[model samples]
Target: MQPSPLAAPDASWYDIPGVRLVGAIAGALFLVAAIRAMFGRK
Candidate 1:
């Protein structure tokens, strides 16, 4: 059976270019923050 249009179970929002770009930026920011926190002080 085919899935209904309203039931898009395979919808990958992150696969979109805009979402990927935003996600990449967010990931980079979070990674920088984590690195700073890990070695910000002795």
Candidate 2:
């Protein structure tokens, strides 16, 4: 059976250029924050 419109699978990450780029930037920022929390200057 086919999925309903509201229940359809999401597009592949690379399919949306803008969202992909934004997600990458956000992920990088979070990674930097985590590293800083672990070893940041007091």
C-alpha lDDT of candidate 1 relative to the true structure: 0.87
**Candidate 1 local lDDT, 1-42, one digit each (tens):** 887878668769975679988988999999999999999978
The most accurate candidate by TM-score is: 1
What's the lDDT for candidate 2? 0.85
Please give the clash total of every predicted structure, in order.
0, 0
Shift of residue 4 alpha carbon in model 1, Å: 14
In candidate 1, stretches whose alpha carbon ends up further than 4 angstroms from where it belongs are 1-11
Give the per-residue lDDT digits (tens) of candidate 2, residues 1-42. Answer: 878876538777678679888998999999999999999968
RMSD of each: 3.6, 3.3
TM-score of each: 0.61, 0.59
